[model samples]
Target: SRPWRRRLWDAVQAAVLDPTNGLPKELRAQIAGVAMAVMRECAAEQPDLEFIAEMNDHFAAALWR
Candidate 1:
């Protein structure tokens, strides 16, 4: 799954708190967009997910980034 949650959360935190973590400006702009896309895709694929639990899962998954 390309470590979607990790990548997503890392991207978000980077954009929020670290503006110059070695990433380029343009690529940084796409961070939030990509994160949202990944979260949406994951949610869609797992229709039976418990919303809060799954969301927590994603946050936990992000920690492994």
Candidate 2:
């Protein structure tokens, strides 16, 4: 398993948590929820590539909004 990936997740979670980061709480929550879901699928014994890709697309679209 790639431990650094988890560290990346930790960083995302931390950003959502830190109010000093300046992002609105609601937007942070929305993005973070998808990130956490991606982490869960990645941690699974058989990660779903399709789901991960779907989540990635969703994240990209979210960024544009």
Candidate 3:
């Protein structure tokens, strides 16, 4: 079963924040940066779908590039 979005976000933030998670420094920063943006948007009363989609696109590009 898949985890909920909130749970997934928690895991991602933990990995990015943990120094011993073993992710490369640059990669961790990238993930943390995107997570922060997404978190902020999600906190809004009415989250913007377009912004979330754009962030997803950018993150996917970074990952696949």
Candidate 4:
């Protein structure tokens, strides 16, 4: 289950890093807004501190790259 989650996360990260260039601007913004909302909800649920920290680190690293 953990491995599956990791794979899913990797796939999402890849998609975020390399989004479809052909997507309309409005559609892209809508997608990103929804994604952020979902992430915020997950954060609010407070599942695991370590997992949150790891995800934060991953996003931080990706942003820097």
TM-score for each predicted model, relative to the true structure:
0.35, 0.65, 0.64, 0.42
The reply for model 4, stretches above 4 Å from the true place, is 1-20, 46-65
Per-residue lDDT of 1-65 in model 1, one digit per residue for the tens? 52553554555645644755676766655655555654565557453335534665765786699
Model 2 alpha-carbon drift over 4 Å, by segment: 2-7, 57-65
Residue 62, model 3: Cα distance from true site in angstroms: 8.3
Candidate structures ordered by TM-score, highest first: 2, 3, 4, 1
For model 1, name the residue pairs that clash.
Answer: none
Across residues 1-65, which tens digit of lDDT does each residue of candidate 3 receive?
12243454566778889988888999898888878777777767777768877877776686798
Q: How does each model score on lDDT?
A: 0.56, 0.75, 0.73, 0.53
Candidate 4, residues 8-60, lDDT tens digits: the string is 34445446545565657675565455445445545454445465457667656
Highest lDDT against the true fold, candidate: 2
Candidate 4 vs. true structure, TM-score = 0.42
Weakest 10 consecutive residues, lDDT, candidate 1?
45-54
Ranking by lDDT: 2, 3, 1, 4
- TM-score, cand. 1: 0.35
Report the error of model 4 at residue 14, Å.
6.4
Candidate 3 has an lDDT of: 0.73
